[model samples]
Target: MFGIEINNIQTDKLFDVDRALENLPFLLEGVPYTLLLAVTGMLIGLVLGFFLALARGSERRWLRWPARFYISFMRGTPILVYLFVLYFGLPIAGIKLTATAAAVIGFGTNSAAYIAEINRASLNSVSSGQWESARALGFTYWQTIRRIITPQSTRIAIPPLGNVFLDLLKATSLAAMISVPEILNKAQIAAGRTVDSMTMYITAALIYWPLTMLFSALQDYLEKRYNRYL
Candidate 1:
């Protein structure tokens, strides 16, 4: 008992495991909405990106120039700005979208610009001979695209598209700004109540990581399956 003060000097841990565990269920409740936004956005990106790819690659200036402008604009702008414009600015134009809808549309269309480039590159990766052979077999242009080109390009696009989806999943956290009840949003609410922002935000990060891993595993499986086609 000679001048010992060990417990007094022992510091508080930065991460409060107990608090994180307590908030686990609340954070989990936000997962469905997060996934919903990511998946819906991805679907939009795929559809719009395909058309954009076709347009961007077209020989016609009318089609190609407009596509180029769109891709350049989206790629150049910050997605957070885009989200704000859609969610906040649109009300002035009498187009008020729900937070979820705004987040989905913003993420989707913004992602499409990048996806279009991926699609274009994937399509180009298919040899010109594939097209020739398709035509030689009396295949219509659409038939050749549908029967031969799509399959090969799809296999090539899977990896990049997976990256896109993964990014979309993580970026959904930004939806909190617009008041979407995504994981980060939930974390913010918990932080306000608990006054332990670090633990709650860390808990949100932990939740997002698993969601990322789950999708990443799915992406890996798809890549392997598509690899079999080669």
Candidate 2:
């Protein structure tokens, strides 16, 4: 009888469907912040990563070494630590940043490291002969890169880029540690209020599922569109 009571108590805490339903709309409020981080960071990563790739592949040692060091440092570090330094450490130096700003910067710069490597590989995959042909036709360095290189390399880079975006999407959850008020943060709020951690987290997971699926389908659509030229 005592064991049965214990089991019943545990079951009550496990999953409260009513609590999850009540929190669903509130959880949905966090989706915009989550997307803001992911999309903005991805845009930042693409731009910075592109330049980093160029620098990494440059003939000049000055450009190459700095790019190499940045990528290595970012890749070697955990993004959580990076976010801490941005959001917490900066204020010590009289350069305070908001949690949202720090999270965006942290994700952007860290993801850029991986994106740079992907960009480098994609750029390298293009035939050297193509560069030669572009030059032979009097194409300037910038011209060749813009007209010939970008299009082809972009098509090659799309798949890995999509993976990076997906990873970034999930990683945004870590922002909760810094009080970014993202999905996990909202879930935590609801959990604290309801005393139903399981239900709140399950609802958060449910929100993440549809988001990931939507983006995955979007990735597929992009791949197909780019491959259309083939």
Candidate 3:
């Protein structure tokens, strides 16, 4: 094995910092795939989640029962367990999907359960009187929801939804378990080759930390904007 020249290494440079900086490009390379998974999962979950939230709030027993059941099932199960089943068991049932696709579907479905509950709670937080007033003004149920409920619920839900997005970003790391070459996956490869576990992980954190901070700042800005109306 070729020995590293310790004397050639700059005494002024911290080994960890220097190694982490050198591995920056490898970590940065995983950014796109991480964002891709997070965005895809969040977007798909948003639509399904809103519908499930609406269903959870429905007066109709038919809609309510199924929505409630779905939420209960998903919320009761761990996301990793859910993904394992989907990734491993589903193919046995003829539902074949690639690892990346499975990760997207799995995360989206799990997040939808939580998102539905968050929106439902936000919907409940809106005053019943608001709905009554809308109905008195000859608004249909849909019109009342569209005009009054949704706007208020959206304002209330933003912080929680943003928090969910942040969670989704972190959760994308799990994609590596299923062979998705996300940030952690690439970091692992680099670490294996370089035998520098500390440096590789540090590099990954450098990447993840800034991305988390960026979303956190956006969440704060939106929360403040909504708070102004309050």
CA lDDT of each prediction against the hidden true structure: 0.93, 0.95, 0.88
How high is each candidate's TM-score? 0.94, 0.94, 0.89
Best by TM-score: 2
Writing each residue's lDDT as its tens digit, candidate 3 over 76-122 gives 98888887888888999999888889999998988898899999999
Sort by TM-score, top down from the best: 2, 1, 3
Tens-digit lDDT track for model 1 on 128-208?
Answer: 999999989999988988899989999899999999999999999999999999999999999999998888998999888
| Residue pair clashes in candidate 2 | none
In terms of lDDT, model 3 sits at: 0.88
Candidate 2 residue runs with Cα over 4 Å from true position: 1-13
lDDT of 1 at 223: 96
Better of 1 and 2 by TM-score: 2
lDDT of 2 by residue, 53-126 (tens): 99999999999999999999999999999999999999999999999999999999999999999999999999
lDDT of 2: 0.95
Give all candidate RMSDs, comma-separated: 5.6, 3.7, 5.9
Model 1, stretches more than 4 Å misplaced? 1-11
Clashes of each: 0, 0, 0
Better of 2 and 3 by TM-score: 2
